[model samples]
Target: MSTPAEFPVTWAPRRTRAVLLPVCALLVVMFAVIAVALPANWQFNDRVLMVLSGVLFAAAGLMLARPRISADAEGVTVVNFVRSRRLAWAEIVGVNFRQGDPWASLDLADGTSLAVVGIQSGVGKAQAIADARALRDLVHRHGH
Candidate 1:
């Protein structure tokens, strides 16, 4: 016979990119337009290349738009650009969101640190602080 299982998520922060990407896109567009229009003389290829490069750069930044962190009974899952990390509650030794840090970082028992990009400071200081507090509470309640 198989046993039914239930795992409740303790906490999950709103992704910072939800607030950042739109603002970043607006700024990128404004700057791109300025760059294109400010020049008195420009070749068609150079203008095309300039605009293409600007768009590509913005795309690279948007790659970070999918960062997220989720914690359930089993563990925490952190999804940041290009990588994902899953850690057990006991593996987390500490959680720190310091004064100048971009996002929260988890200190593990193995002496390594992992970044949780779902919560970031730049979007809004108050929101970031609240998210960090919530994360710490989750670690305290679910972790050792």
Candidate 2:
């Protein structure tokens, strides 16, 4: 059986393009450079660079593709390649929408911050603001 408290509220990677598009662009640039600079017989070095580049490209893709939000009865988690964060429902004091901001974030009672990685950054300003406000309200209603 399920109760109101049992329902899970989850947010995930909504726009992977933020992570993927840059990595893809870098890969293209690197490929062009390698093709232009390397000689035909440099097989070993070419292979090594290709392998390294492939690893980095894959890493970036994975970071972008990875799920960024998971909220359950306990808390929510947000993952970023640079840094990941977890916040218990009790830990989050509030959520706010900022003017001219590029992304959504959680404002903790401790005066720290956590970006809402699942929100689309480039969406229409009004819609994004409204969504941010709605998320804040949800936290207020159901979180701490």
Cα displacement (angstroms), candidate 1, residue 72, comes to 1.3
Best candidate, TM-score-wise?
Answer: 2
For candidate 2, what is the lDDT? 0.65
* Model 1 pairs in collision: none
lDDT of each: 0.73, 0.65
In the range 83-131, model 1's lDDT, one tens digit per residue, is 8888999898888999999888899999999988777786777777776
Off by over 4 Å in 2: 1-6, 13-39, 65-67, 123-127
* Total colliding residue pairs, candidate 1: 0
Instruction: Tell me how far the alpha carbon of residue 1 in candidate 2 is from the true structure, in angstroms, after superposition.
Output: 26
Question: Could you report the Cα RMSD, in angstroms, for every candidate shown?
Answer: 6.4, 5.4
Candidate 2 local lDDT, 1-144, one digit each (tens): 112244465544445656676677777578656755677787876767765775677567766655455566667676665677777887888775577666678888788887775654564665556556656666776674
